[model samples]
Target: MQPTHRSRRILRPVRIWFVYLSLCVALLLSYVPTGQVPGVPDWVALLLAFWCVRERQHVGMGAGFIFGVLVDIGYGAAMGQHALAYVLLAYAANAVSRRVLWFTPLQQSIQILPLLLGAQLVMVVVRMLAGAEFPGWGYFLSSVTGTLLWLPLHFVLLLPQYQPEERDNNRPI
Candidate 1:
């Protein structure tokens, strides 16, 4: 049976702040570095990647540049450091978003790992160009950590918008 207009609208839960809140959480986490590695997982990059994969139209390279600038300022790193990296990351995520979104979050985690690594790689390359000392292989660990965190982050961010399971009244005998 087709859902009524009201039910249809109800089923399509869309909260604008859900995206902003996720960004805010990532922004805050960026300031709170954690991990046994030399670099912290790029929280904002991961967040941006998830949104790009989940909802491309709503988030894109522009969003990445904006947040990337914020991170650059917050960390007092080189200007456009994260900006360039994030733009590339979002662009990459958006590139394969179609195929990636079709998979489960766990699968997405695996697929997006390299993109996450690429973002970190971009950042490292930028820092290196700016004459910053190499942080060693430990720096790359953030990608793995970020990839592992993707499933949890995806579920938690989507939790608020999740609809209750519909009754299977149309089940066949």
Candidate 2:
């Protein structure tokens, strides 16, 4: 049976709430220190990048900025550090999402490498500017590990497929 417009509107909010809940869970998980999990990536960044790719409209730059601020507050870090990183990362993910149909899950995962790395680099630069000591190369490992986990995470999350129209026309007809 076809639902009325009112029902559709109601369901929209429910879907949004689910997304918000998932993000909150991801945030909480990020704070859980991994004990001897030698190579676990930054769960929050991985989740955020996935959200940026999958739900660009809902998880836009402003949302990223706000989330980053929250992270900074929670972790007791310099203000605007995570905010800048999150917003920049969100923008990068969204920009490339427009051309995403050409990429497989593996390719998309590979693409995340640069975004993650670039975001970390920005964070490092910001921290340096704020007179924070260097955390060393290990700090950047989170981005690398995050990128590697993207494909599996995407599959696990069951994100929506890219629309056919979004596919690039520059390739074979």
| lDDT accuracy of residue 96 in candidate 2 | 86
lDDT of each: 0.85, 0.75
Local accuracy of candidate 2 as per-residue lDDT tens digits, 61-116: 88788788888887777898888998999999899886763567787888889988
Which 10-residue window in model 1 sums to the lowest lDDT?
3-12
- In candidate 2, which residue ranges exceed 4 Å CA deviation? 1-14, 34-38, 159-173
Model 2 TM-score (2 dp):
0.77
List of clashing residue pairs for candidate 2: none
RMSD of each: 6.0, 10.4
For candidate 1, write residues 1-173 as lDDT tens digits: 75342222232354767887888899998987554545467889999999888888888999999999999999899999999999999999999999997677788899999999899889999999999988789889889988889878876887766555554668421
Worst 10 residues of 2 by lDDT: 5-14
Clashes counted in candidate 2 amount to: 0
Q: What is the lDDT of residue 10 in candidate 2?
A: 14
Please provide TM-scores, in order, for all candidate models, with all chains considered together.
0.84, 0.77
